[model samples]
Target: MSRHAFFIAGDRVVHVANPCGAGFQYQAQSHVLSPRAQVGPQQHEAAETVLVVQQGALELMVNGAAGYVPAGSFVRIPAKTWFAYRNVGDVAAFVLCRTAPPQPARGARKITIQIAAA
Candidate 1:
């Protein structure tokens, strides 16, 4: 089951159905990153992260192996694997991100004002 959801957080334009709050364990969001932006060589301790480039292109480096993922391409960052992503394209890159076991929220909290359907 899915429900339409929308929110904006930092530089990410998130638009996806997230069932985490309703008690579903896994979480997902469409992350829209700005052009030339780079996400760190971070590692997930518990949940494995799956990222699929929905639009534009992203250079994904997983455990030192790098590959360019264009729209409709996906890469999996296993738990404890170092990974990063950078949008080399001039346009904004959209990535569909899903994490199993629901990753914990970190840093500042942004108010998620739900967008009402018309």
Candidate 2:
């Protein structure tokens, strides 16, 4: 098993934990979304995801339903559920995302899909 600690910087999504890097059962990522930036409209076929809001606010659209997620809050998205999020505050939004059973490495086998916006 590989184990190491690392730092994540910049205003982009960074995987903090993964099978290849940390040998963790789940994949953890740090996302820094600039104001008005959006992400997803995608679905995880076999992995459930949990999103923790660390700073700023976000508008989450899950399974076609929209809701507000403020700092210090979190949201769970079940497998196969379509989700998307956008920074709703003027400042950058920091979010910690974890997906269980770690998503397949890119090109291994597609377990995720990009869906059309509603």
Residue-level lDDT tens digits of model 1 in 28-73? 6667789999887898788898887778999988889888898877
User: Which sections of candidate 1 miss by over 4 Å?
Assistant: 1-16, 102-118
Candidate 2 on 1-118: residue-level lDDT in tens? 1222222333323333344643334566778999999999999888888888889999999988899999888798988889999999999998887777445545454334333434
Best by TM-score: 2
* lDDT measured at residue 30 in model 2 versus the true structure, 0 to 100: 76
Local error of candidate 2 at 58, Å? 0.5
Deviation from truth (RMSD, Å), model 2: 12.0
How high is the lDDT of residue 14 in model 1? 53
Q: What's model 1's TM-score?
A: 0.67
Which residue pairs of candidate 1 clash?
A: none
